[model samples]
Target: MRNLAEKPYVREEQREVQTVRRQIRKTFTRAEKGLLTLIGAAIVFSAILMVSNYASMYTQNQEISQLQNDISQQQQYNEGLEHQVSELSDPERILNIAEENGMELNEDNVRVLQP
Candidate 1:
């Protein structure tokens, strides 16, 4: 059987221990708090870096797409100019234009140069 005289003393000691345990459980250690703060800061920094890189990549892709469109337009314009050049340089077209202007081609007036 337990000692009846020590029962109240043991109950008081148990209440004090429970109070200390509750206080300890309610507060974080300083090192643990610092570590948690550092982890949160790292997560925020990583998110910022990821967003910045994504924006940079998106801008570059848009520029590249615009440049490709410019190249396609320039190529089409160059092809049109090539067709005009071929038409303007045609011998039959040149002869018709000269005839309209009252110009004649004489075999005796033609001189050939050898390279």
Candidate 2:
């Protein structure tokens, strides 16, 4: 039969052992905590750097696309100007303009220039 009124006697040695066990249960040492903090900071920094690089690359790609569009438009404009030049430089158009301005063409005095 157990006596319920009497409290269990805990020895000082046992108490000390229990305290040690509680201390042992602590998950991380100070150095391990510092290392974990450093690792976490590094991961955050890497993420930020990667985002920054991606943004920069995206901006550059957009700029390149705009430049390509501009170049294509300019090329089309240049082709238009070239067509106009070719049309305006036709010998018949030139002769018509000259005759409208009361100029006579002398084939004997005309010289053709070769490129």
lDDT of 2 by residue, 1-115 (tens): 7799998896756434343434446589999999999999999999999999999999999999999999999999999999999999999999999999999999899999999
Clashes of 2: 0
TM-score of each: 0.67, 0.75
Whole-model Cα lDDT of every candidate shown, in order = 0.91, 0.94
Which candidate number has the best TM-score? 2
Pull out the clashing pairs in model 1: none
Q: Give the candidate number with the greatest lDDT.
A: 2
lDDT of 2: 0.94
For model 2, the stretches where C-alpha displacement exceeds 4 angstroms are: 1-24
Candidate 1: stretches off by over 4 Å: 1-27, 108-115
